[model samples]
Target: MQWIHNYQLFLFDFDGLLVNTEEIHYLAYKTMCANRGINFNWDFETYCRIAHYKSEGLSQKIYAEFPELYAVEPSWEVLYGEKKKAIIELVSNGAVQLMPGVSSLLSALQKANIPRSVVTHSPVELVSAIRSQHSILNTIPYWITREQYSHPKPNSECYLKAIQLLAKPEDKVIGFEDTPRGLTALLGTKAKAVLVCQIEYPEIPAFIERGVIYIKSLDDLANTQL
Candidate 1:
């Protein structure tokens, strides 16, 4: 596809965009809360809304809804630690699965010899645990995990770092993200932002207006006019 030539360096968000860990993360959250006898009522859609968009408000909302959680664990980090335990347990049996088109897209990128890296807020432990299951993931040239960046998603600092290291003056770039929070980071960079998700989030129109593109899956690049 001609569109493949539009970018030289490619940046990707690692969780939901490259793999199906979003659902796994949600399951892990629910499991951790359930273990504490806390009822996490958010369905997948609600989880997407908060986790993908207004993540900054997540701690406040949870603390307000479940004071017991706040009393036992004051910081979300403590709760996330529990969640991490659940994630490791759940994926222990090699449960991690690639998102649709992930294999083909990654292989294609490798074949083209285009430099691509994963930029993720996930810790190296989890990213490695899940990614190690898939051999195709090893093809990624670089990985920027949570420990590598000061500011998280919705802040362009991480993506900018990837760009600074991998990009060249004459080469264009494409950054892939599946969440609004992650996509926001790419929008501020020189790379063209590509949202990779099936959800029809209300903010899609606005993101499109701002010049971000959408594809249900990377395989759609075959038909996309981009």
Candidate 2:
């Protein structure tokens, strides 16, 4: 809570940090692999490697490791189309839900008049779909999606752009991220970074070693004085 008062701007990652959509994405990938008969079973380690990239970059990262997939797998366009369709079906059927503590934390920030925004690798269409189904977007005045940036997370370009857009000093901002790469991107900027450890990943120690604060959920901040 003391940290919340230290920042003038707050930035957040979308998938696992704000919503439970990461599981939806994982399911989409799992379904795609099954349909293609690809022997794909992702543990946290493997997921972390490609999780921070945008759709195209993720495909490229996966293909580099499994070149055989390049031949057997559908083009990124086709594969992503299928993934999006799957997400749409799941969300439309009331299968997906927001992560716990998201509403309360956002409301707390709003009540304090802190400027907050989402910086995510998700494309605008996907973001729009989730927003249409939920009221999450109402708490955020601005967002930087993949479509707005030339480079995505782990590259630092998107975070840098966000700071520029906010016109705030980097030291006066804070970022909440759920992945290693997302943390790296935020650290590249002037903002203090926190790791929302909703999912256990093997690289968590490394992040902690780098001085990133980790929290179980946004609810942990409820007792913090704004």
Candidate 3:
């Protein structure tokens, strides 16, 4: 808990950490694949491997794994467009929901006047939809989305950009992430990383071995000094 007090800025990953959009995303992907006559049987275990990547990266992974499908329909742009449409429809219909403890944590941070931002690979349109549904965006000063960054998670560019924008020392920043890629990106810099185990990741020990802290939810931060 003392460690949480050492940081001046807090960074959060969007999808599974701040909001439970992973399931929605999975559904969208499944629908898109089905529309194209491709069998999308990715379990949670398989999805976790490419979950943190950008839309293009996820498309490339899918294409690599199923070349036959890709050969039949090789346009990643088309697939991504379909996925985005599905997500937008879902969000518009009030299907997406914020994660547990996110609202309280944001309120606490607001009360403490601690600077916070969301660093995510989600595109602006998707982010905008979520913002429309949640009041938390008003509390966040900066949003480092995929549109702003050339490189995504596990590349360190987004995190480094966030550090630069926050104008805080790396040691003064702490990050909350739900995926290994996001954790790796945060740890690559001087910022301490906390893994919010929203998804089923079996590689917790490896993350701890790399000096990242692991927590089950944002509610756990309530016990800290803040």
Residue 187, candidate 2: C-alpha displacement in angstroms: 0.7
**What's the TM for model 3?**
0.86
> 95, model 1: CA deviation in Å?
2.3
Per-residue lDDT tens digits for candidate 3, residues 14-92, read: 9888888887888888888888788888986578667664535777788887787788777888778898898888888
Q: TM-score of the candidate numbered 1?
A: 0.93
Best by TM-score: 1
User: Where is model 3 more than 4 Å wrong at Cα?
Assistant: 1-5, 53-57, 64-68, 200-202, 222-226
lDDT tens per residue, model 1, 69-178: 78877888888789889999988877678888888888888888889999999989888887778899999989999999998889999989998988887779988899
| Top lDDT prediction, candidate number | 1
Specify the poorest-scoring 10-residue window by lDDT in model 1.
53-62
Q: What is the TM-score of candidate 2?
A: 0.82
Winner by lDDT between candidate 3 and candidate 1: 1
